[model samples]
Target: MIKKRVLCFSAILSIMVLSKLQSRPQGISIENPYKQIMLEHAARLKEEAKSPRNNSKAYFSSLTFAEASVPTEDVKVKSKLSQYLAKFSFKKVRSHEMHNRADKYLPKIAKILKSYGIPEDFKYIPIVESGLDPRVSSHKGAGGYWQFMPTTARLYGLKVNGNVDERKDFIKSTHAAARYLKSLYEEFGDWTLVAAAYNVGGGSLKSSIRNQKKDDYYKLRLNGETASYVYKIISVKEVIENPRMYGYKI
Candidate 1:
């Protein structure tokens, strides 16, 4: 009878162990909870790898002159980028309108720039120049999306008369800007310098280059606006391309 009882107790213990095993989750070992935590952590990392916020380098690398023109490693460029990133506000920028206009216009601008062998990055100029607003004008005589002064507008095959300002015509002005940028690239042989020349004028940039004996845009001591111009463009590019990273819904 004692032997019978011992056998019954053994059978009951086996059933209890089997029931406990079945009640626990599948594929997860209670003996090693850390392995499940590690698996979860690895999955989270994989998901983060696919997110843009964690892939800023990939975005930067995809751009033309990714390293040469907008060197984020440079102190001045980094500081200016921080300033602009801080300054960028989706509410103030009218994110929906700006993004909608960008979606409408940036492809055309990129096409023109591409036709001229200009870096597609130059398409960001209008974003920095006029907030992509074709009707916007500067305190100076600069007007339109490209922000061309009247004389520069006329020089670049844009009509600047009272009746019609071709600078406000997105397509025509983009073409003109493309041509102007091409000419500037010929002069500077550097897209970064071309951007600087576009901002401060070829003559002023040339003089600065000659006087400072520095051909590098990052090294040149320029007026505040001109100095920050390229950095602002880079910043705009970053904010636009990584809007969610900058707290911009659009």
Candidate 2:
């Protein structure tokens, strides 16, 4: 009689447990906890976007100028950047043209610079040098993307003879430019100075820095082109990187 009572009680307990489980909501689940988080994110996406909270600061946040000299705040630098922003870069035709040309050459130049442990941002040097045009020639005989003179080209292991000027060869010229930039980096230990030295030669930049005794690119009394060289680079960097900010379509 006692055993029979115990059996009956066990059966009653199992039925009660089943009934409690069945009473719970039908579709709720704990299988994937991330489901709740993802649903919250989906709701957020449905909300409207807001404009930049601080437009001026936010616009410049895209530009770091990392591993290069001339901060965005410097007067001369800003002046040059402003010049491009106001005129050529913001004008859709011009901005589109330079960027379209840049697309072909910057990748190879950036890769070569990286291989030599140089800053990849130095790729913009070509945009400053020749607007990424391999066939361009300056009044002073500087040629190719990096605008190396024949002597400098030869020195950097590029053949610059009548039959073959390797400076015109994008692949070889990028390598030569990397080598030349590495040497400049060694001389000045500053990428901005390296770029300046590239434009006016290392000896000239060294002399200017010594004469000025300022050891600052902004203060060094350079020729108009060289004085404006780094600022131009920074300017191009700003506009090219932030085309939309300058009102460029692409």
Candidate 3:
């Protein structure tokens, strides 16, 4: 749960200066505004070379200047997004309700997944899917913790009826989700892509993989939403397991 680090503008500029100083040892430290002074000094040195007799006391005096001051590179600057997210966390509010509702449903979800020998991370599917709200429905009619559409939910053993839509049932939907995730993982052999497929369907995901010529999730070129989706899930998992790492109290 390491916080993401970003270097400051000045720090990056200093690095560029240090890189340019590699060929000239006796001149500018280049880490200071004295860079202009050093440039003038180098120009005078060249002038002295052009006319040897012009290399007088004035030229020698300028070359004997002290080293440029080194500004502290250790200064830590906070990221604006990190600061903003810390001041206001929607996850904190959403997660409170989830934790309460999860107590009544997570046990059932875990039991089904465990009985099928699914990975424990599968428990997070509900959080990413519907925030564990049974009545949740996507614009595409994907419903429940499984977020299965009308056809796919039934294909995976969830019953949808006028009186009782099993997609809204925690136990049945978790099982269906587990089976679907497992099947996608088997097909792609990568959990990250499997999660992406869960969002955008397996057919399009496979097409992306073929078009990119990369089986690895990190290497594939995906749309912005799909690209960040896996990392978002991982970020949520990291935050939940150890909230303090991301400046969360819970």
Q: Which candidate leads in lDDT?
A: 1
For model 1, how does the per-residue alpha-carbon lDDT over 97-174 read when each residue is reduced to its tens digit? 666777888888888889989888899899888988878888888999999999999998998887999999988999
Residue-by-residue lDDT tens digits, candidate 2, 1-250: 9999999999999999999988865554653456778887877664312223125445444444535434556666556656655554666566677888777777877778899988877888877788777888999898887788999999989998879888878888888888988999888988778878888999988888888786777778889889887767776776776676566653
Worst 10 residues of 3 by lDDT: 63-72
- Sort the predicted structures by TM-score, highest score first: 2, 1, 3
lDDT (0 to 1) per candidate: 0.80, 0.75, 0.63
Number of clashes in every candidate structure? 0, 0, 0
Question: For candidate 1, which ten residues in a row score worst on lDDT?
Answer: 58-67
The reply for model 2, stretches above 4 Å from the true place, is 1-54, 57-63
Better of 2 and 3 by TM-score: 2
How do the candidates rank by lDDT, highest first? 1, 2, 3
Tell me model 1's lDDT, rounded to 2 decimals: 0.80
TM-score, one value per model:
0.72, 0.73, 0.59
lDDT of 3 by residue, 194-232 (tens): 778887889988999888888766556777667655545
Q: Which pairs of residues collide in candidate 1?
A: none
